[model samples]
Target: MAVNKVKKVFGCSECGTEFPRWQGQCSGCKAWNSISELRVSSSPQVTRNDKLSGFSGMLESKIRKLSEIEIEELPRLDSSFDELNRVLGGGFVAGSAVLIGGNPGAGKSTLLLQVACNLSLNETILYVTGEESLQQVAMRADRLNLPKKKLNILSETSINKICDISNQLRPKLIIIDSIQVMYLDDLTSSPGSISQVRESASALTQYAKKNNVIIIMVGHVTKDGSIAGPKVLEHCIDASIMLDISDDSRFRILRSHKNRFGAINELGIFAMTEKGMKEVRNPSAIFLTNKNNNTEGSVISVLWEGTRSLLIELQALVDTSASSIPKRISVGLDQNRLNLMIAILHKHGNIQIYDQDVYVNVVGGVKVSETSIDLCLILALVSSLKNKSLPENLVVFGEVGLGGEIRPVSYGQERVREAFKHGFDIAMMPKANLQKNKPDGLKIIYVDKIEDALSKLIDIIS
Candidate 1:
């Protein structure tokens, strides 16, 4: 008989990489001062096999050809919100684990509660709250006017008891109000610790996959807006979704960072209302609200997100620098990319803003990550420097290369059509993106080089 023993190890909170002892820097994530100690008991081999069997559902393993396996289509549970479905790559898949992270007041709970109420109408659903009490959840549900008759509520922090209750209930969907507070009895580490978080998430994910249950776990975010806990928690889940509050507190954006069933970097827009979270069907229109016509340094660009296109405004401000080292500040845009765009404008467009305080922003607090906005940003900077406003109804989008060539972006036709639907009169883009038949009311201006685009802009503005 072997005696149980305890061992101490260190792990990185950011990446969940383990080390034999303490280290100043985590080699896995390269994070400094993030290493923490964890004590874990050496359980018997039988205990390990029991957990493994719960995941694999097999006592013995055999090898077979991949082609010999048959494929089956698993139906998804629609959350009744189109935006949420789109971000989730259609809907919640069976036997899938999804992690939703957000700041405290970002409305993560409200969104999930709304979804759970809607989903409970058709299927058996279990709502487990470890952070909030049952009465608190019930009050919120009543305040939101959500249907609560069908949903089953449970308040538990122990993973073992949760699984036990799940076994009896056999709910099709189980929602963990939060993962950080959940603990496993076998682990000596406290809840929310690195060891507890990683193991709890792993166990839940395995249980989800093995039992063909859809489990959506709410996770807390760090100050930096990243999901709190070991990075392995994200890896074990089928999808990692984040809910963020826009610059306008009234709106929220749901983004999918990883998805096994659908596209990555997908975005879903929502509005916080008195009743609950409402999906923003037309995000472009909402983002372009309250526009001041003929404003210098302001331009509209067509951005392609996930499977759709959006018309977003880009604004730039160029002023004489007061300090020797000019400030290069950007809001809702990458700082390094701003620097690169400035360099491109200087070398290719022949505009020198190196001495000026350059500030760029995407209107409406929408963070634009695609490179398609490069030309729009640079042109906005030029418009600001010269104090000449671009056309009020013009939409511009194209990538700028180091060699000064205007490169076409993906889904150019879709972008053009989206812009045209919004009543944009002029569309300035790369020549390569020139379609055979332009929209009825939209004029297409195709430019081959950065200078050509500027010259054509002069032609249009004149």
Candidate 2:
């Protein structure tokens, strides 16, 4: 019998720490119960015959200087959906890996499957699903009623088999239903574990790059809505798309969390229908509803989401509270910002919010992080409390500070243009943003303070 040589190997899978032998705890990384053992091969690893033959073989595989490398820039392939194409900076690039992550039932699969069906013109697409069965995908395809020509579906969980299929099919585009369910036979780790996800993603990414195939991987998210699995999985992808689901099921928004080839903060809006997802051409109209007339505590604000412009409804309500501590609740808008705006109202405008419950919300179930909606929210709260209404066809947008100054928001011109396009007769914005040459046929009301804006709207307020 051959002599067996036992080797002691220690490593922490999470922190990548190596030790002399397996320990209950990893001292280098301070992680308990993370150390694992791996058998070391006694024989030297095999090398290619060319490497054994030395210098001439080395010359053939010599590293090229950076200057000698050809720097050709390849363009991305345009998808049939203009919104998706625009967000991806003109289209999906060959051999690029993309990660799409979102909450459960956030339509990540639906969106990607729609793209596959729409873009299957003359290009072969391989849709591999580990989570769903072949029957489930078939049902979805039947519902979509897509043409049955170029799209192929494979329900697989084995990484090795998937790669083998990819090699045999040589698809132009490949989509993995999810990264969590994929497993490798060589790895001892179970599927969806950190190690398994990382290894599977690395293997798929390497294969895609080598074959010049566009690959999109759907990823499951944590409870906090972040992508599940190790952070390394995200780092390996070329771009990341985050789909946001609102309380209202009518609208779904797609935002780029990371993009190596395109602008970062781009937003795409889609309306979910019985016939899959449909792009919303004019999102402003959908955002601004109940358009018969304007009421108290309602103000229109133009918000910029990347290159697109959206008109948002800012609504606030102030009522007397029965308890000692007034309830302050804000949805889709920051609660701290609402408090600060109330403080400014108390100090500058002599309006008291103490001992009162304040509720603020952005309409259409959309969240607004920008400070530009500050002035509009404050004015809306005041108007609602006083039981007064602003102008019916007027829009307001500006940032409010603790000092009661109205700051100019970015893309003020775009905001005004969007408002005008939506048939608003007048726009109230920061005085600092007034230009010498403004657009024709639109009234501009400039205000330096929140109180100044209120003064201009007093005609309708009374």
Clashes of each: 0, 0
Error of 1 at 65 (Å): 0.6
Q: What is candidate 2's lDDT per residue for 94-203, written digit by digit as tens? A: 87888989888888888888888767777888899888888887788789876646788899998888878887998989999899999766555568766678778877
Candidate 2 clash figure, as a count? 0
Clashing residue pairs, candidate 2?
A: none
Compared to the true structure, candidate 2 yields what TM-score? 0.84
Q: Which runs in model 1 stand beyond 4 Å of their true positions?
A: 1-6, 42-46, 49-59
Q: Per-residue alpha-carbon lDDT of model 1 for 251-312, expressed as tens digits?
A: 99899999999999898999999998999999999989967899999999999889988888
Give the range of the ten consecutive residues with the poorest summed lDDT in model 2.
48-57
- Top TM-score hit: 1
TM-score against native, each model: 0.96, 0.84
Tell me the alpha-carbon RMSD of every candidate.
1.8, 5.4
Question: Judged by lDDT against the true structure, how good is candidate 1?
Answer: 0.89
Candidate 2 C-alpha error for residue 255, in Å:
1.4
